[model samples]
Target: MRKLGLGLAAAALCAAVPVMAQETAPAFDAEAATQAYMATLSGAARAKSDAYFEGGYWLILWGAVVSIVTNLIFLRLGWSARLSAWAGRRTQRPFLRSLLWAAPYILIISLMTLPWSWYQEYYREHQYGLSNQSFGAWFSEGTMGLAISIVVMSLLIGGLLALVRRYRENWWGIGAAATLVFVAILLMVAPVSIAPLFNKYSPMEAGPLREQILSMARANTVPADNVYVVDQSRQTTRISANVSGLGPTIRISLNDNLLNQGTPAEVRAVMGHELGHYVLNHSFSLLLGFGVIILLAYLSVAKLVPVLLRKWGGRWGVTEVTDPAAVPAAFIVLAVYFMLATPFTNSLTRMHEQEADVFGLAAARAPDGFAKVAMKLSTYRKIEPSTWEEIIFFDHPSGHTRVSTAMKWKAENIGAADIE
Candidate 1:
């Protein structure tokens, strides 16, 4: 009688198992979910976004052409050679001479490019309702940027000129090494020294939000001690955040636009994505990857500069590749190479962004939030793109791609949200 009773109980338990499983299971339809997210944007908004993004594509090509033309004009008009001569006459000290030369050159470049700069950065932004900045405010920021450019260029151009004068034939090789070091230093300093020139950064207040961020950071081993908020709304209506810098200087900063405009879930999704950058060591990877790209660029310039000099050397008043006057010509070469490299560079960055998106979905468990934030990003980004367009231009996955990724994650997790 006891054995028979035990057997019946086991049978009853087995019968109930399928019912329990069915109750716990989540019902998620990835296709429907993704379609629903995409439906949130009106047809007009989508078209506007596409127009903005496509316009940027043309601007990039035009900008490159303008830069090359400007440099060539400076070379042909003997402006570069004249500057070199003026600097040489003024000071025997290399550093002083470079600074004096660089000041006028920097000013000239800024002046020459002002129309394009104003149109792209100020007028276009205002036209799109992306900027809240007044003309005075915009001009002030521009002046500051110009000053910063002068200072930075003075140092870099000064060093490169000195290296060119010293090394001549072997300068590119040595310069490549120096360039890598400079890159490292720049990365270390930019977050603290350079970024604050534009915006205020304050620690995020202690709260559930902070706690949540801390928990995520801890989970990912990101080594972030605090969350910082930057006043970005003063300039633009873009929401942004990053785990920037390297080594002990690494910082997690979100713009005020994010805090003001984002929902808690959206914030979490964004933070999770940013944290993935740290946890995955993307900064290091990008730095190293870009360093390699620069090395290749330098190598190509080494080979190309002399060939170009041989052709137009006397005409341009650049007798040799190492002539201080050759700076503009060298810049043109580098710019051309960089332009050609854009698609490859964007591909690499986009791949990493997609990885971070996956990481964010798993870490934040906020698929809807991710999709919504992606839609908001459609303010500036095209919601969809042709495969080749994305391959060549996008530095991140398209809005459609991002939303679909989240929905796919949701479909897999299904009822996991309810259970949690």
Candidate 2:
């Protein structure tokens, strides 16, 4: 009887062991965890980030002003008319004439805006310690970008002018459709062709990390066989990755900065987020949404341009909307329209980013890793901002928002086997 009782007691204790372990586990406090992550970026680091990001708000306004002013200058001085007249002299075909006009117009505007571009892209980036290139290197890249722009813009202008001349009444709708198609083509081609012109891409070295990423891609149904790494460190220290292109052109690429600075888990977190963009079809969705917006912009331009041309066409030497010389005036209208649409566009992108964040949390199951990457990004992005500020200015969730989201996920997923 004594031995039987002892054995029974032992069994009872064993049964209670698992329950006790469960009861003893501490509850995960999401808000506390988020606050702890926020605390990581404090003092000068926080201030510097805030300053850099806030300065960008001013830059946005100033950039719009500069663009509008530059276009206006072209109109006011009749430079656009002169270019159009020169192109007409060179070619009888309206399409070819439009292309000729666009090439020089682009070049001249680029030159006109070079001082501001230097300040905005080069000087400002260096001032914030975000750039790694010297002035010569920066200018070299700028020249490449300019050449690409001239070619692309010239073709677009030619096509737009042809549409305008052919369909004066409904040109806006047709032009909008053509622009969207052109944008889609650019998206498809840029990942393979244009991106390589800026950075060298090579297969990620054979290793467990590469294998792990490939496995993740497979699990997510991402059609990728290999990972590519870009030499982005030569340009900037920003850690970035992308799953870009459409259909056959799709490429999964991470910059060397990410490889050098991130832990395996952090890399996975970032890649998972990028993969979410692909899996969710964000590229197509974004293009579609922007297509609607572009269509609206075209409608507005269509209505307004004719009225303005009738009033000022004589002075500007622009006879009608179909005139290539009217391009700057059209651009002026577009610049204003886009400037006003900034908040809507930002919100659209921010919502997609938020959705990607949620997907990343689920896929990576590395909330802490995600939080840490958010902290790193705070080096350039303001970690915390006023609610309205975020809504108005941010195109991605603020760092605080990202970290809090990660912590919230962690809280719900406490003790999960795969969570780290």
Candidate 3:
């Protein structure tokens, strides 16, 4: 009877072991976890990042002012008129004349804005320790970009000017449609043709990481057979990845910075976010949204340009909406429209990005990884911001928002096998 009692007690103790262990396990506190993740990015690093990001708010205003002033200078000085006249002397064809006018107009504007561009893009980037390129490399890339812009913008402007001449009153609607089509074509072609001009792209080497990314792509119905890595480290240390292009042109790519800086889980988290963009059809949705905005801009320009031309046409040497010289005036209105629309545009993009974050958290199942990467991004992005500042300026979620999201997800899924 003594031996039996002892055995029974031992069984009872064994049965209670798991229950006791479970009871003692601490519940995940999402808010605490979020604060802990944010704490990692303190001191001078955090201040620098905040300063850099905050400075961009002023840049947006200054950039628009510069652009508007530049266009005004061209018009007031009759530079645009002289250039258009020169192009007319060379060609009788309206489209050819427009193209000729565009080449010199773009070149002159670029030259005029070089100082501001250099300060904003080169000096400011270096000041913030965000750039990796030398002045020569940066200038070379800028020149290439200038040439591409001249060609593309010239073609687009020429087409629109032709429509303006033909359609007269209805040109705005048609021009808007044409611009959307041009944007779509650029989207399809840029990844293959234009991006390679700046960076070399290669297949991600065969390995567990590559296989894992491909596996995620497959799981998400992303039509990618392989992953490509871009040599973005040559330009900046920023980590990034994307599933770019439309339909048949779609490419899955990550910059070398991501590969170098990110752990496997971090890579997975980033890739999953990018894949979410594709799966959620963000590109198409954005196009549709922006198309509406573009239509409104064009409509406003249509009404405003003619009125301005009538009042200032003689002084500006621009007589008609169809005149190549009038392009600057039209774009001045466009610049202002877009500048004012910045908050709305940023919000639209931010909403999509947040949705992607949610999708990535589920797909990658790497909440901690996601949180860590958000901290890494704090090297450039402000990790926290006031609510209104985020709504107005940020196109991506603040790091604090991302980390908090990940913590919340982890809290809910604490008992999952893969979660720690």
RMSD of 2: 5.2
For 1-420, candidate 1 gives per-residue lDDT tens digits of 443454555556778555545444345668888888888886788888888899999888888888888888888899988998898899888767777878888789788888988999999988888898999999999999899888887788778778877987667778877877887888889888988999898988778977887788888876556468889888988999987788878888988889888888899899989888877889888887787788788777777888878888789887765556777777788888888998989998999999999998888888888888999998789887899999999999999999999988887775564311
148, model 2: CA deviation in Å?
0.6
Minimum summed lDDT over a 10-residue window in model 3 is located at 17-26
Regions of model 1 farther than 4 Å from truth = 1-26, 93-96, 417-420
Give the residue spans of candidate 2 off by over 4 A.
Answer: 1-26
How are the candidates ranked when ordered by TM-score, highest leading?
A: 2, 3, 1
Better of 1 and 3 by lDDT: 3
For model 2, residues 56-125, the per-residue Cα lDDT tens digits are 8888788888888999889888988898889899989999999999998999999999999999889989
Q: Residue 351 deviation, candidate 1, in Å?
A: 1.5
Give the higher-lDDT candidate: 1 or 2. 2
TM-score of 1: 0.90
Task: List the candidates ranked by lDDT, beginning with the highest.
Answer: 3, 2, 1
